[model samples]
Target: MLNAKWKKMLVGSTVGAMLVVGAAGAAFAADAASPAKSEKHAAKHQAKLEQKAAAQGLTVQQLLDRQAARKAALEEKAKAAGLTMEQYKAQRQAEHQAKLEQAAAAKGLTVEQLKAQHKERHDKVVEQAKAAGLTVQQWKDRKKAEHEAKLEAKAQKKGITVEQLKAQLAAKKAAK
Candidate 1:
């Protein structure tokens, strides 16, 4: 009963509608797949946490409580800022990147160069720690103690208290 022009229009509309539906179905399928991926990732993270807790001689519940407390603190901060957690995290990440860029500029390096330099230093430290049969944290603690001893010695040589020396150093840093 339709004319040739009407038939063409009907066919075109049907094809367009089918294409839209197909696209929607594909998007829905992708959204559905994301949850499975997230679930797997979450399970792996939980297992890692349990392993870490066992290594540290802490109960899994204790470790989880610590994590939950940290998360609650972050959530409260986000709420105070009138932002969702994701938005607050994104804002903080952007600020961190800006600080990195500023530091790199001050050091006459590109951001990538600064990052690479940091990674190189970190890798060297990790290698040294492994060679010395010390964990990274243990190595860092030893270095910190040595540095504090040197600072204390310097303070004594200058006839200044440690707190006064620290305040002077902080003032110099702020001046810079």
Candidate 2:
């Protein structure tokens, strides 16, 4: 049998060890990176990039213009395959947005709910694109087709009809 003093000491030491382990676990949990910090890191890196560009006697806007020209040239290359630049941009955006919506819907957000919440962000991006001279209708058409294609692919992969998946998604959202 343990003596009273030894029993008390053992209990105290066990509690102290647990406290240390708990504190260490909390520290590890809090070690995740924040998006804002990452954004700041990127902004700082971009500033350094601009400094390099300036050393080459080029402004950031000039670099962007060059990139835009390259993109236009690529679009022309893609035209041989019957795709326009606007179509390509919209298709890419829509496919990505579709996947995001799929995941969000899987998490119980209704299509209407997701669209309503994201409409402002979408409008702001559209406004920015208009400011940058991209036509809204062209972008919308391409994006719609791409998103439809994504939904079709998802349906095919799951061995379900597109309408059935849509209904299931709707039902899931409604239950939530």
Candidate 3:
């Protein structure tokens, strides 16, 4: 009887240890699969800050700051036209708004209508992406392929075949 009891206890302990170890291993695996908890916290805070900045009309600096070059170009244009930079900016803004208004009027649309159309276009693109069953990177690759195919078709219409284009591209790549 004592031997049987000892055998039972040994089995129970072995099973219990295995269960504990399995639970711990699962926890460790989950932790490894996830981004660090602190990174998620930081990301949440950064998103909130970005939302606040957008609401407050604060512009983030782009990796490449085009503003200086844009300003210099505008100043040069203004000088050429015998107008101050400020005057040129105002004139351009007015012209841009006028063009927008004219386009809206021509389409029998309000500014809101134009915005809605733009949003619809964005939604359509998103829907197409979802329908494609591809990841974002994969979708981009597919788009590049489709664009190349369309370009090839156009070239074919102009008496240039895809094989010729591929050969030319290969030659150009080799030259580089």
Candidate 4:
């Protein structure tokens, strides 16, 4: 069995893989729609990328480069593990599913029941966002902005820049 640290690393990598796959799926779906819709989706995605890059004090190209680099690194890791990319992804996914099953059993619920509960919570959040006249993405963006504002205020109180505060927090986390 893997140790706790290795398990955590695997889980984090699995989540990263999921996000990359999800984004690609979304882009593919958008392209499958009408040309106008595809253009709109592309514009929206670009805007999001710009926003994220700005938040990280990076240009859009720099952000894209980083994402490409991360993907290449993951691919290299899969190669080193004697697995193709697809095989590595499948293995990681199976591990993640097993962990979910264990968690559900510990909670006295089956995996299906746990999934239903999660879906219900997600639906509720979507409904809440709708009631606020915002799309789910918009709602999430608002919440993120609010969180950053609070962090900025706290950093100001400590007489540090937000970047400095974030670096300090990251260093502390790494030390742990």
Clashes of each: 0, 0, 0, 0
- Which has the greatest lDDT? 1
* Residue range with the least summed lDDT across 10 consecutive positions in model 3: 55-64
lDDT of 4 by residue, 1-176 (tens): 99999999999999999999999999998778879887889999999999888655578999999999989998998999999999998998999999999999989999999999999988997888879877676778888999999999999999999999999999999998
**How large is the C-alpha RMSD of every model relative to the true structure?**
7.0, 23.1, 22.2, 23.6
Q: In model 4, what is the error at residue 156, expressed in angstroms?
A: 12
Q: Give the winner by TM-score: 1 or 3.
A: 1
* Superior candidate under lDDT, 3 versus 4: 4
Off by over 4 Å in 2: 1-119, 131-133
Best by TM-score: 1
Model 2 sits at a Cα RMSD from the real structure of 23.1
Put down candidate 3 lDDT per residue, 1-176, tens digits, no spaces. Answer: 56988999999999999999999999998888677776888899778766555433444343124456787888999999899988988999999888878888879999778778979986776577668764444566688999898878877887888778778878999998
* Candidate 3 collision pairs: none
lDDT of 2: 0.80
Which pairs clash inside model 1?
none
Cα-based RMSD of candidate 3:
22.2
The CA lDDT at 133 in model 3 is: 67
Each candidate: what lDDT? Answer: 0.93, 0.80, 0.77, 0.91
Q: For residues 1-176, write the lDDT of model 1, one tens digit per residue.
A: 99999999999999999999999999999999999999999999889998778644567899899889999999999999999999999999999999999999999999999999999999998898878777676788889999999989999999999899999999999998
